[model samples]
Target: MPFISQIERQSDYSRFSSSTPIVIDNGGSYFRIGWAGEDDPRVVFRNIVQRPRHKTTGETVTVVGDHNPALLRYFDCTRSGPRSAFDGNVVYQFEIMEYILDFGFDRLGADQSQIDHPVLINECPCNPNQSRCRMAELLFESYGVSSIAYGVDAAFSYKYNQKKGICASNGLAICSGFMSSHAIPFVNGEPVFEACCRTNVGGYHVTDYLKQLLSLKYPHHSTKLTWEKVEDLKMENCYIAPDYASEVKIFQKGDKEAEEKTRCWQLPWTPAPVEEQPSEEEIARKAERKERQGQRLREMAEAKRTSRINELENEIRGLDFLVKQLEHVPENDVPAFLRDTGYASKQEIESNLAKATQSLRKAKGEQVENEEKGDTSNAEKYNLLHVPDEMLTSEQLRDKKRQLFLKSTAEARQRAKQRKLEQELEREKQMKLEEAKRLENPELYLDLLRAKYQELSEKVEQRKRQKTNGNNTNGKQNGSGGVGRGERLNAAQRERMRLLASAAFDRGKGEDTFGRDDEDWQLYKLMSRDNNDDEDDNEADLARVSARLREIDPTFVPKSETGSPAEPPGFRPLTKEDFQILMGVERFRCPEVLFHPNLIGIEQAGLGEMAGISLRRLPSNDEALEERITKSIFLTGGSCQYPGMIERLETEIRMLRPCGSAINIVRAYDPILDAWRGASQYASDMQLFQQQTFSRDDYFEKGEDWLRGYKFRYTLT
Candidate 1:
């Protein structure tokens, strides 16, 4: 399991005297605090703070370090996430630092008005003078401490390991922490800060890179790959490869060893419910319901027809009575009588009576014999037309001309009806011939029909592709960029563009004669955006072919009407494979960044390279000292706990040193806690604290120049 916060308050604070100094290993990743001379810190937690709102009380409260995520249900954490005080291993934000300090001291059982013990804390190597001054001011002014001492965490770890006989006095310490990695060469049991080198790539970069790559590869589970979770994953699975390229090849070929190394994290999922088929009785009940609804509709339609027939019969009787009454009235009184009945004249009344009689017969389900009546009335209807116009009066001549017009119109309509009947006969004959041919060879006929359908479909699709400029690779049309100024255009559009370009550039070359010829005016029509003749013709031809195939072939299924390729269904039942996160190459690829900082775009020397750089920067010119330093190289930090880290570092350092040089690498007893333990042991010496620490009065009296040049001695007895 990963490290959990030890925030249970210690109850023995009152037992210690006021002179006992407080040792704090203020690291970029964790904050450890304990009393001097102790074997372990009294309080340890992640160096982070969160200001979440209480769900019940609706007030913001500070939550420091990792808490029981289950208990967080009582708070609303949307506004503020966990925040750190360090910016790339430097404490620039003091406000957050203050919160972390408050939690650390409170957990250590400090109940006094202000912390009164002398404090010993660790800071990064070569820390800026401004940052150190601000830190001193905070401790002296806020905590009211009598004196404070600052030291490097890596130096403390090195001294602690040295006391344990892990390495000689002259050696190198490779400290790879959370935010950055450093290689500090120690001479005679003292850390040499002037010869140290740092690379801004460490455990934090590895975890972040893994999180990003996994989130992009499986975007649907991005929310599940939290920073804390990814950090845990990196610690559990990541390792330094002996040969990056060769090790990656094992995974690329999917070898058995790679499979054995792979880890799978299964997410939550549930199977979809199976659908049940309906019973025979249920299907019968639905059919009966539909039949009853149809019967009700038929009865209502019959009643409506009966009511309409009765109304029409009454209208016909009234019109016939008015026509009979028109014969008795004088011609002068007929106009007034017809006006009261809403008819213009006797002829109009007769026409209305005939139309009503025909409608009443049809509504009663009896066909009207209009064709027979027209055939019988033909002789009387054209009687005036056959009379000689010159031998009759002027009124007779006008009546004969009207009768001739009616006769010609009637004949033309009959001819049209006869032509329509002949065309229908021809279509029936053609269908019979095709049906006979199919009956003789059904297989051949179906093959021919399918081929015809496919050809027409392809032709139509090709036209659509040309119009769209064929950029629809994802099955979605190029809605915006297909026909823009610099994009591809169709044949007609290209020609039009060429014409416009010529017209524009031709004006400056010579005298313009744009509209001198009649044909030149036609250029505007060609450039019109409404030109769609080819599209319309293609659509009509496709429709005709599709209809013909559907009539001839029983197994024909036309493609979708939208012309675009059919898209897959949006929803699918998820399976175990969908939820499983596999770790193949990712296991070692993330940690590989430490040995090759350039892999993650960082241009600094890696941890291994930094060791060689540190050795070269030593002020000593003796080759014997360099050889001795390489013999006692020590790896001590939180990141040094990886499985193959020692081996990988030894190999890398050997490559950088001279041939046949002796190389040695050892790990600290407890990489994560040794820094705090070492500081606790060192701070136990009261006389050493007086020698290395500075009082607040000295800080002001000695001036800023004195503080800038201040150095701590780590070899104190």
Candidate 2:
């Protein structure tokens, strides 16, 4: 593994001459910079930029690379994350690229107004001219570099390995980097771009697949699986499976080998909030506090009652005094005397006194009359009802009519009360009978009750589904489907539709007597959306059955509006194991995406398949040339370092080739830094390096057409 550490600024920048070429591998994942032909890059950081606000200053500052854990406390980076300047290894956003370059150059200890040295950067294969032009413009205008050169990272790694005798001049380079993977066929030491194929599946996709799996398996621990942590896990544990199905079967069968291979990352687990028993003192104090609150509430209620009783007594006394005073006054002077008490006459004063006396009795906790003593009061209350209209005066006749109305209203109310009391008695009798049956045979009664509940619930659910056009609990259509133009409707809605159809079909066919008949006016009510009048009856029956079942059976749970159990159907108690996430199949399963990209929903060719595709695309139909490419197959890039990668690729390519074909899959000396090392070796020769690069004057004079046609010759290196 490459040594990953925080990049420190170099102090020996001035030791290198101005003519020294700076090597930069502007990869999608990381950035590296140093003098050309060096043993290693002097500075390295994640190739990402961030503009986060300082928490104390509230100023947005440009920060490059991964956020340091120590520095995160000083910045509000919630709204921003490490952002890449490349779009799949090709520079697209110049502003972000500028930030990355600034950080890379600063870390390399560039302390000049202009870099002065030539820059050699790596880009993806078949990069567009727009990307090159933008990069060239930025380097020339922003950094003021002496010259700029571009090379593919894969090509550099391939050439570097080829010179080391790891691969032949005519071979294939299978580089699985961060954002994407590539298989480039080489002919006479030059990478064959026409025969190369790229799969948009690499380390990033593998890490993402693993992250998704972890999220699904342990949703509560999402924040624990950061990208960097998952990347580390991938590096530490993930490996390509020799055969996906057979490998998966090992885990599926729960073999000991699978358990041995499974990796466990024990996250920081905190104990759950267990219910602990309280000490005697704690319990006693709690009970005392509760009792004090209850006593205070009771005292408050008692005080309020006493205050009300006193007020009622005072009102009664005042009314009694008014009544006594009115009794002494003359009849003509009675109205004037009562006027001061807001009463018009002696009868009004007596009515007020009677109300106050009744209230005072009630507030004093005395039994008050029910006021519904119709059997006793009816005779005196409607005395005038017995008198004939002609025998009585006009005022008496009016009173008789009012008394008659009141008598009928009172009788109706009494009948309703009697019916309600009889219904209650009947319900009580039925409940007692049901209770006796339950006691006689509890299981049988419960089964019968559950059956009834189930039947009613289904009936109610069907009716509800029809009314809602098959919408589920979420108000969205369920698997059965939604309410389209031909949606099934309830009986009332169907009838309304039938009536509407008839009305529409009758247009110009007969006389329009729609509103002539009184029955025709009822059409609009039936056409209304709320036409299901008997739905409530079915729901009420279902509710009754559900309630009965709940009363008898502890396991019975009521269905919700959508007919699903309000709570989980079976009360399967969750254990700590449910919270734990065990990774068995995922170790090899995630890395298998490089061989089967379809697992991640990407329809691109896999890494091994890309090799086959690249070989088939070669113009040379000679079997010897193809054999040479297969025999010296070289694997480069960070993702190619997986434990079983070479074995898997060998197995995959062996199946595609003819029997006994020479298939040697070799890993790069350093899959990651070899690209930079290759570029360094290529840039060591000043004459050859200068030939491959373009100065600022050359760029403006030749125009973009020349830049589009640019390709560095690795053979010269």
Candidate 3:
């Protein structure tokens, strides 16, 4: 398992004396703080901080190190994720560093206004003078430390292991830490910074590469690949391969061994509930209920029709009685009688009676036969149409024009009816022909029909794609050509635009004769918004083809228009494969970067090459010194905990050394905590601190230049 925080406030902080130094292993990935001479750090946590706004209070609060993720529910963490103080293994942001230090010291049970103990902290190899000075100032001014000592983390691990008899006085320490890797050569029980080589590739690069590859491979699950989760996965599964290329080949071939090596992380998923199919009885019940509702509506409509028919019949009787009374009365009295009946004349009364009779028949569900009677009177209806207008009076001439218009309208109606009949007959004949062809060779006929349908569908779809500038398969349109300055136009639209442009610019040019030609005037009509005949024709053709395809092909499914509703989620049952995150080649591929920095686009030499480069940079050209360095090669740091690291590094270093050179690879007792353990052990010695550390007053007098040259000797007695 990856390291967890040991942040329980120590209750016995007052028990330790003031002279005792507090040792802190301020590594890139984690922070470890404890009293000197302790086996393990009393307080350890991730070196990160987050300032999230409280959800309920709307106040931004500082949260240092890793906390229970459940408690973060009260804060809106979107504004700031977990931020580290280091940038490429160097502390550049002091504000974040101060927060980390405060948390570390608080967890170590510091209750006073300021810490009163001497502090010993770790720094990177060949750290910048500015960084070193700023750190010293922070400790001396902010924390009120009396004195401080800075030492390399790898050198501490090397010294700690040397005291434990893990390596000799002259050896190589290959410490692969969080952000970078280092190969430090130790001489006479002290680290030689001149001979050390640093490669900017380490655990951080490995985890980042793994996270990126997994995210790219499974974009849907990219949100699930959190940094902490990926770190845990790396520690659990990733191992340095004995032979990267060969091991990759084994997975590439997909053998049983590869299957055994592959790990799977199943995400949270629940199966979708299945819908139960209704039984015959349930379907029948629903149909019966619908039938009862329809029957009740029909009865209501029948009752309404009967009532309307009776009322119409009564109106017709009253109108007929009024017309009969008008005929019985004298011509002078008939006018007064018709006025009481709301009619102008006897003919008007008759017309009212006929309309009421026809309405009554219609209400009773009987046809009136009005169209047949009207057709029979066609000769009499157009009698005035045959008469010449010159022979008629003014009123007669108006009647004659009306009769002529009625005759022409009747003729057009008859022609339209005849054309509709002919079309129906033609369609029936064509369907019969298709049916006969299908009967003769059903398979071939189906194939031909399918091919025709596909062709027409593609043609229509291609036109749509061209008009909308959309993808045919995905149906996504490009927004670039949408109505603006550089917008695309169709052929006719382009021509109209060209005409408009010409008309606007032609006046200033030597072409003032725009309206002189008839064609120039026609340009105005083409540029008008009414020019849409081609678009209408294309739409008609597309609709006709689509209808024909739908009628002939039983399996044809039309494409949905854009912005339609997508399929509902849980449409398909959840499967195991959907949740399973497989680790096949990624298991070893991530860690392989240690031996090949170029894999992650880093130009620097890898861990293996750094060893040889470090030996080359040594001052002595003696082969015996080089042999001793190789013989006691030490692997120390968090990254050295990978399963096959020792074997891989041994094989890698052997290739770079001379033939038959005795090489011994040793691992630190606890690669991760040994650095802090070594620092704690070294700080416990009171004489060593007095010899190596500088007081706060001494820091002001010595100046930054002097501080830059200061080095802590690890071989002090």
- Cα-based lDDT for every prediction: 0.83, 0.83, 0.84
Better structure of 2 and 3 per lDDT: 3
Candidate 1, 465-525: lDDT as tens digits: 6556654324444566444433334467667778776874484466577767767667676
- C-alpha RMSD for every candidate: 9.5, 8.5, 8.8
- Deviation in angstroms for 471 in model 2? 19
Deviating ranges (above 4 Å) for candidate 1: 1-8, 52-59, 67-81, 255-257, 278-570, 700-705
Tens digits of per-residue lDDT, candidate 2, 421-451, equal 9989998999899999999999898888888
* Worst-scoring 10-residue span by lDDT in model 3: 481-490
TM-score of 3: 0.75
TM-score (all chains, Cα) for each model? 0.72, 0.71, 0.75
Lowest lDDT sum, 10 consecutive residues, model 2, at 1-10
After the best TM-score superposition of candidate 3, give how far the Cα of residue 550 lies from its true spot, in angstroms: 14
Best by lDDT: 3
Error of 1 at 431 (Å): 6.0
Instruction: Report the error of model 1 at residue 564, Å.
Output: 9.3
Q: What is the lDDT of residue 254 in candidate 1?
A: 90
What is the TM-score ranking, best to worst?
Answer: 3, 1, 2
Judging by lDDT, tell me the better candidate of 1 and 3.
3
